[model samples]
Target: MKNLERFLSEHQQLTRRHFMRLGAAGAAALGLWPLTADAAPAAPELSKAIETLEPYFTPREKFRDVSRGKPLPHSLPDEKKRAVGLTRETWKLEVISDPDNPATLRSPLTQKDGTALDFDGLMKLAEKHAVRFPKVMTCLNIGCPLGMGIWEGVPLREVIWLTQPRENLRRVFYHGYHNDDPQQMFRSSLPISRVLEDPFDLPPVILCYKLNGQWLDSERGGPVRVVVPEAYGFKSIKWLTQVVLTNLYHANDTYAEGNNDIDSWLKTFAATISVPREVKPGEPMPVTGYAQVGLAGLSKVQVWIQSNAVERPTGDPHFTTAPWTDAEILAPPKHWGALPDGKIPANTLGFDDATGQPRTWPMRLAKVHWAALLPGLPAGEYTLRCRTIDEKGNAQPMPRPFQKSGNAAIESVDLTVKS
Candidate 1:
């Protein structure tokens, strides 16, 4: 079973690398709920929640439904997709001429905030450069973790470069669509160097136009959206009517406005993965789950396995004959984006903040899902847990001491078996 664990771990990292290579297209394929589906109209619960929180901090804007594109997947039949038709004509693309020029770009309808941009200006920017198609866009749906599309337009780096920022400009920010409401625009940010890098060389970031190869539906924020790599889905803002560049190093000021300070680099939370409870010892177990690098990339995933079992309904516990084994750390491949064929990139060696070794404290891997298996357990229940480290050597909080808004908590699953 240890061998099986090794195999599972290898494949999991591979899948994550595959995910990076696909970028926004991969996100589109991840899942896209049909816009026309007869979902119940908006509920009051959301507004009430937003209102209750208003007293403590700056008001936040409510996000609108902007996913109007078909999901990009290989399985769907051509007939199932809607025709792009003339709707495509209404949409246009844009690029920021100078990443640091930062005159400001926001929707024309926005009040004169000295930073709003109109569609015409956006198009003018795009005409100057070639915009890529099918970038991934997702939302951190509080109700349900789901993603969809709105054609995105912008070369992320161009906007970064436009700012003509100083070398210390280590962070990039993003804000979503909003009305007059304070929280109207969902805001987030990522490491500046990652996005500012050359996408063709590493393809760090890209914008999207069509979802599933069709024009985005208006309700789903047809005109434009954004896709970012090596990050959680939330950072990929939609209804991208605005692109702002600044030298300030800050998390989501919008989040700060909301009273809870959210770090731009979405922190990796602590989580767990258990060996499937249904499987018997010696049999191959299905190990699957997702992990994120916050605003960076995953570095390593470490698993701890013990033959001990906790007593059932009764309060008994006992260690198994197969004593706990040494911890296993599954290291991920160096690069997430596609690499030159035949060239194997080494994990960008790093050191744990606490230690100087290549490995960081609380282990970091570029991808997650490196497997862990307990072979030949005496037909008893066991536990499998994981901790993740990012390229920066930041580890997911095990019992995450504090309940930070963006903290990624470790997760675990139970294993039950009968021999």
Candidate 2:
């Protein structure tokens, strides 16, 4: 509890690059949930899903297929896209509850008189804190860059404290404003035990009012919103309005309704990037791209050297260490056809570039690494394979685990490594 309080106070403003810097110094630290108040730190445990899949721990050989996903729905522009403006007051803020009674805590963020919380006050509150690195922002699109920018706001824990909950509180829920009917609005939940449970907790889950250090336009969760450190972007809940606490499990939010589809455990899946599919060996090779897991943080990442010269798998191979040197070589002019669609439904993996076909398996991974291997004597053919492991032991699976939403799960990449 002491460590968690300190972490929340310090990291409420940590930036993505800084987090990466921390990773560079050492493998990322995993967030361990305490089973009981007296449990020792070394006692290892598995999440519900991990325990269920304990039978399928067969690690295998795989390759990295870079040109996997075509694009994302957000990339299509017409899907969930909406134009947001600088208008601030049009939005309303809400403060639900602390850690126990979500239903009874439901209420709008407002003044003592019950009027909605004003945008100006929210902005002022955001600026009062000392944020370290800017919050990283990434659109749901696969082809886009992982955006990094400063976010300003109060620690979400602070707000929760202000609302106050009963003594036996344990978890909390957050709901964001949605254009869909109130019943269909986007919402997610977090474990208060975890929120206030660590010492590294910095930049408390902020009630973000600014993005890139500027007031957010309505398009983004504007006027006000929630930013959590341990959950995925969806769980961050934009245009946030209410927060509730409950003792029982509630899986009825947007993603939860789909059995928590792409987001069940919050683990970032592994992927390989080879859109252009051709790279010259030698010279300064640029291996650029991003990888993400849900709430389970990233621990180690790996990229293999491959020559673009053959048909390959949809995803990248499992990567456990950096600077992969023993990667397989590829033959030149490899004519890989469209990614093979498998058990997981098509048009479900990732959207097709030409056609909006739901993607499958490896094709769902959006980002890839690019490399210009050391200058070579001859240029026959080559390919690259890549994969990642999160703080937890989970790796991106081959055929993504069966789920309603197509979000990738922990699995290894299977690219065709060539040279």
Candidate 3:
């Protein structure tokens, strides 16, 4: 196997034009057509195209474990038992919107008339118009935890359309049931444009009922939850129960009051590497990890390895000190899953059909796997670092602004290259 450093050095000289031509040919070789670089498709055409490709989308096999550690707000002992006992027929989803006051954002899932829909109702709509897509959910608190899953559900636009918001409505506020505890309540808001429009080629916000072909478990915020493809997990609002259309912008998220950016998009292409903590010299080491971005799907990932002595002598320790030369761009998985001999699975929804690049949606969610081979090094401690380039050409923040917070920082692993 070629060492990662050598692999990177070889491709580093390719210009953008050369890279694109190669990428197009590579995709074609895999039986996938490059997206047509023409005028944007109309909404109806876009919807039809997405619907046509829905059945061919492929999901990753390994589901990362990211369970919320605390007892969920509504998860009392009896409530837990009740949740487990509830069937699709017994479950209900409420949709609420206060067009009059817009200030009284009470209730979990409310509507203009204060009516509720049973699970069957939700399923009926989803069965007819549901879309299947992959989305990466990362906590806003930075390195808290993250997970990627295939979500199936009705578009929030369609669901909200059923309520027929008043003409003046400008925003939508939503939250999940918290055992009727005000103190435990968590909520977030979205611009009405986001709810109703498909700007930036973003996947529609979904009221997801199923994940990876299975009904969601409570631990994963199931029964039903909102899946915001562009934002952090906080905006996804698990245990989702209420959606209130208002004319004013409101940030009610419990964490938003402090340092969290409630409306921020998941813009960083950060990664987590899986490597041995220690390795012997001359030993062949395989480096692997996953990379993700908010809306701008990943375009490239680069990995570098350097000794500790090559320091910048200033700036962030985790970042500025590394010698990034000879870094190699990691390749994506050759086969996502079992596709026909010459066919490719739809792996992302953020791809712009017109430009063959990821859209610049602030919260567009997508992820990809990356792997490389690392050559044995001389006896010394070394750092392995990885960074990602998004479709929009945004490079990972060097010495990331929030390394301590773990948000979008270059991922580094320390290892002893022993003799």
Best by lDDT: 3
- lDDT of candidate 3 over 210-270, digit per residue (tens): 7766686665676788888777777887777777777665555665676676766776565
Q: What is the C-alpha lDDT of each candidate?
A: 0.39, 0.40, 0.57
Decide which is better by TM-score, 1 or 3.
Answer: 3
List residue ranges in candidate 3 displaced over 4 A. 1-70, 73-87, 103-114, 313-322, 325-364, 398-406
The predicted structure with the larger TM-score, 2 or 3, is: 3
lDDT, residue 291, candidate 2: 52
For candidate 1, write residues 72-176 as lDDT tens digits.
211224332222211233322232322553334332122243433344445556677524321222233231123322223556665445435444354556654
By summed lDDT, the worst window of 10 consecutive residues in model 2 runs over 54-63
User: Model 3 Cα displacement at 310 (Å)?
Assistant: 3.5
RMSD of each: 16.4, 19.6, 9.6
Q: Which ranges in model 2 have alpha carbons more than 4 Å from their true place?
A: 1-86, 97-115, 127-132, 138-146, 195-199, 261-287, 291-301, 306-323, 326-382, 389-419
Q: Which ten residues in a row are the worst by lDDT in model 1?
A: 51-60
